[model samples]
Target chain A: MINVLVGSTVLPGNLEAVLEIYRELVARTRNEPGCVSYELLQLREDPCDLMLLECWLSQEHLDAHTRTPHFVEAIAQLEMLETAAPALIYTKSV
Target chain B: MINVLVGSTVLPGNLEAVLEIYRELVARTRNEPGCVSYELLQLREDPCDLMLLECWLSQEHLDAHTRTPHFVEAIAQLEMLETAAPALIYTKSV
Candidate 1:
């Protein structure tokens, strides 16, 4: 499986906006083929910090996700509200 | 629920040792009370980078886990093999 940890820092006043996008993105992404899990987490220590824990069946599935309409739209919106580019760590089970 | 993302970088030549430590840690931690999930992930881009994805019922449960013998011992051994202190991000579902 392909596990992805996506860490993003929201802009000072854009938390709500970012979350709105995620609500849509996550809901849609979860229904995609090969999606095992797609969860959103907000940091307790730093409210601006958000993380997406995603699991996919394979690299092809993950690649397809990136090109999907929901992903493209959500990412564009997220980029505007985020402090900088999100940090993505692609991983596999140890 | 309390979710934790722990990022650790292993020292060169210590991957096997670190993995050994985690094998014990993950197995023991899974049997602990209030442990919803405990998984280890290794970065695809950087083999030395590892991440722990954990979920618990509450902060109290997580605190208890830190005080457990298995946790303490495993952490001690991990520190010796890791390049630096792990980065812990405590979180809650958004």
Candidate 2:
């Protein structure tokens, strides 16, 4: 399986907007084929800090997710709310 | 529950050593009280990049984990093998 860790920092005053986007994106993404898990976590120390923990059956599955409407829309919305480019770490079980 | 995401980069030629430490650590940690899940993931693009996805029942449970012998030993060993200090994100389900 493929695992994706996405670290994002929301711009000042954009935390609620970012969370709304994530709520929709996560709900839609979880039902997609080959989605093992899709979770959104907010840092306890700083709510503006968000992390997405995603697991997919394979690289192909993850690629397909990126092309889905929910994923594409969420990224566009997040881009505006984010402080900078999100840090993405693609991995596999060790 | 409390979630902790740890990001680490291994020093040059220390991937094997780091993995050994994690193997032992994961095994021991899973058996600890209130450990809901503990996973180690290695980046697909860069093996040196590692991420730990951990879940515990509560803040107190996670605090107890850090004081455990296995955790303490693993941290000491990992500190020598890591390129720099690890990035830690303490979070809760959103």
Which candidate has the top score in lDDT? 1
Off by over 4 Å in 1: A84-87, B84-87
- Write the residue-wise lDDT of candidate 1 on A38-87 in tens digits: 98888887878888888999989999999999999988887778854445
Fraction of true inter-chain Cα contacts (below 8 Å) kept per model? 0.66, 0.57
Best by DockQ: 1
* Model 1 docking grade: medium
User: Candidate 2 chain A: minimum summed lDDT over ten consecutive residues — where?
Assistant: A83-92
Model 1 chain B lDDT-worst window of ten:
B83-92
lDDT of 1 at B30: 97
Cα-based TM-score, every candidate = 0.92, 0.90
For candidate 2, what TM-score does chain B get against the true chain B? 0.89
